[model samples]
Each structure stands twice: as C-alpha cells, then as structure tokens.
Target: MKQFCSIAEILELYEQYGNEFYSEEITQTSHALQCATLAQESGATDELVVAALLHDVGHLIDLAQHGSDTTAFESDAKHESIGAQSLAKLFSSGVTAPIALHVDAKRWLCATNLLYHDSLSRASAASLILQGGPMTSDEQLRFRSHPQSGFAVKLRNWDDNGKALEPPELNFKKFAPVLERVCLK
Candidate 1:
C-alpha cells in the first residue's frame, strides 16, 4: 500500500487542488508552514512540527474532490481523521495522533475545561459538535488515556492560530525541503 507521498507528488496534488480552498489569505502550503513554525517556536518535538505542517494535508484531498466547505463532510468525514489514516503508515503515532485528535482535543478541552469551548472558531464551534459535541463522558475518559494529551493540546492551540485572518507571508518552495525531511526514511 502507498504510505508516504514525495514532495514533488504532494506538490502536484496541491496544484490540482487549487489555492482557494486553503485559506483566503494564504496558500495551503503557507498555512502549513505557519503551523510548523509555530510548533517549532514553542519547542515542540521535530515530529510534532512535521505533523503540524502536514496536519491539514487531508484538506487538500477533500478540497480537490469535495471542495472547501467543511460542512461537505456531512459531519462524518473529519478531515483530521482521514488525514491521520493516510499518514499513519508513513509516520509514527506521535505525529499522526495529534493530527487526528487535534479536533477531538478541542472538544475534550471544551468539555472538561469551562474556559475553552467559548473561544472556538465559528467553524470549529460548529464542527466540534458535529465531530462529537464537546466530548461525551466516555470521550473524556479516553482523552485522558493518551500519553501525549498535553502535546495534542498544544497542537490544537497552534492549529487555531494557523487559520489566521492575516497570516505571515510564506513561500511553498521554501517548505518543500520539509516535505522530504518528514517523509523519507
């Protein structure tokens, strides 16, 4: 089975997907780079930064095939989960799990921490409910079971910022090297 996508291949996929679906202010590549930058600045592990960079790779596919609206998933096709599954065989759980659970981590925090749910993005606010709604009691029980709960929280926090209305300028070519750095063994 195919696991990792090469840098060139990933870029080709992005080209077909178009830039409009990523963010109005930044290209998909730029948004990813910003997330990676934030993760690195915060002293997260190298793997975490890589995960941050590629967390939304699945969005590329969704937009390519289904278009930009998260609502297109009908609340079931969590891009995070689809992305995680796609990357799982290529990377460690340390990387994939955060990408997968970042959304759920938000819900987990919202359910257990009173100060959080209110601050979610309009899209996230709605998507969170669709993704399981502020974590059921059972979900809370499971979130605490993870060893990297705190790391997932950080990833989620960075994810929120990655969708900035006016993110810093970034070039896709510059981060191209990162694709190789993370993907090849």
Candidate 2:
C-alpha cells in the first residue's frame, strides 16, 4: 500500500496526478476540491472533509500505473478501498471509513431511492453497473447499519455533485493544512 509521509507528499501527488480526466467533464483534482468544498459547506467535520479531498486518491495511484485503461473504469477497481488503505496510517476511521464506503453508499442510495438513481449522470449511471449496480435489500440493510454510512452518504452525494461543477482555483496547498490537522499523527 502507498503511504504518504507528510501532507506535502500528498499535495505533490495531487500536483502530479490531479489533472487526469475523471469519468466525465471533471478532472480528478477538480472533483476532489469540489467534493471537499461541498463537504465543508455542508458542515462536515475536518476528517470528513479530508476524506472528501482524498477519497479518490487511489485513482491517482491506479492511473499512474494503468494509464486510463477503459477496462479500469469499466470494472470495479475498488478505488475506495485502495484509497482508504493507502491513507489509513495517518487518518482515523472518521476519514478512512467514508473513503472506503463512498462507492457502496452510492449503491445503497440507488437501491433505496429511485430519485437518486435517476439523479445519476450519464457516466455515473453507466459506471453503476460496473460498480455492482444497486445493492440487494440485505446490502442496503448492512450499509444503513454501518457506523460511518451517514457520512459516507454525504461524501457520495458530494462525489456525484462534484463532477458537474467547474474546477475551482483552490489547489492542494489550500487543503494541506486541514489534512495535517486531521491526521492521527
């Protein structure tokens, strides 16, 4: 697993890979900044905000090696889990759990709410099938019961909304301090 030794290293990683095109119109950095901004605007805790910022870090790592292979996005690379594991050393579950579960939360929302599934963008809607489509009733139950599911849902919503907005002027430096403050170390 990749481990960031300092906030600067994470920022450097963002500098290096944040501009990659995500699923649709947004770049990876744009999506992350937008998600973090949304989380902060929604009164999320610092850890949750950091989680929002770093939630897609795995994609940075993955795409570095994989080079935007269609097969990658077409299949479930488990980016959520990959990101959570990579950041687990510096952050608590408050941060990592949401990073781990945002995709599952999307699945949960799809199974439980027709409006939500309908709200999905063309790319997101397409990726849904690859990301395991909707959850079963049993899966939804488990998701609801999970300790961090609420926050994960919040992040998931931001995740969807983030892709639609224009990228902001804010960059990794603006977020580095928040991440540093929330780190377990």
Candidate 3:
C-alpha cells in the first residue's frame, strides 16, 4: 500500500492530479489557492485552510477509479467522503473533519432548509432525500449535534464561491513557505 504522503508530497500529488482532472477548467493549484484564500479570509485555522485547499482531491482519484465524466452524486459514494478519508490518514482530525463533513452538511441543509435543496448540483439533487431523507428526525438531531457543523457551513460557502479567477499575484512559491512552516511544526 502507498505510505502516508507528506505535506509536500500531498501538494505534489495535488498538482499532478489537478493537471490531469481539471485541465479543462482551472488548474489544481489555482483551485487550491482559491480555497486557501477563501478559508483564510473567512477566519478558518491554518489546518482548516489547508483542508479547504485540498477538499476536492478525491476527484482526482475518482476520475481514475470510476472512469466517469461526472461524480456519482445520488449515492453515498461522494468525492468529499473519499477526499476526507484520504486526507484524514495524512492530517489531523480538525483538518479532515471539515473536508469530510462538507457534503453531509450540504445534504443536511438540503433536507432541512427548503432553499438549500434547490441550489445543489444535479447529482446532489438526486441523492438529497435518500442520504438521510430531507433532514428527518434523526438527521435534524445529527446535523445540529455535529461539532464541525459551523465549520462545514463555512466550508460549503467557500466551496460554492471558490471558482477560479486570474489571480492578482501569482506567487506560485508563496504558499510553499506556509505549507513548510505548518508541516514542520
């Protein structure tokens, strides 16, 4: 089995996977940068920001493993879960929790909040009800009870707005220091 990848290794994996999977849209580096910026601006911790930066990483593996054009959103086989699980093995719980719980948070909101359901992607719309069925009695309690619910809420917002743009200062090497600093601590 593959060993737990280091932070730099993870970053490299992200770069390679991103180039392969998102070549049509924004680059993986750009996506991670945007996510990190959003997380930082929103007052997330360093680790959480890192997690946000790598949230969609599972998509890389998903494309390779599932050989599909789109993610299977109607089932529990979500990229977020896959990404979260993958990240958890390498990072701390605080970082992985937001990544892992984001999809569930989206599902939770869709079930309970009428407005949330309409805004989901096509695949998400199909699986909204079955993945705990529109915030049932148990779901409602679970949603509220989750410790990362608030962080998940923020993460969702960032995920929605983390669209790529031409970065103002493409300091490709800037984040390297931050990553090193955090990892070495």
lDDT of each: 0.73, 0.86, 0.66
Best by TM-score: 2
Candidate 1 per-residue C-alpha lDDT over 1-185 given as tens digits, one digit per residue, 9 for 90 to 100 = 22445557666765666365354355676677778889878898778987888787777767766666653335556778777877776667888888888877888989988768878766667667677788889988899798877778888888878876676776556656655666634
Summarize candidate 2's per-residue lDDT along 1-185 as a digit string, tens digits: 77766777778878988888886677888889999998999998999899999999988988776777643477778889888988888889999999999999999999989999999988778878989999999998899899999999999988988875566687767887898799877
lDDT of 3: 0.66
Candidate 2 has a TM-score of 0.94
lDDT of 3 by residue, 1-185 (tens): 23236666665665555555233456656766777788888787887777777777777667556554665443455667778777655667777788877777776677677877777655456655555556666876887788878787788777756655574445435566555555533
| Model 2 misplacement above 4 A | 70-72
Output the better candidate (1/2) by lDDT.
2
In model 2, residue pairs whose N, Cα or C atoms come closer than 3 Å (at least 3 residues apart or on different chains), thus clashing, are none
Which model is ahead, 2 or 3, in terms of lDDT? 2
- For candidate 2, the per-residue lDDT at 82 reads 86
TM-score of 3: 0.75
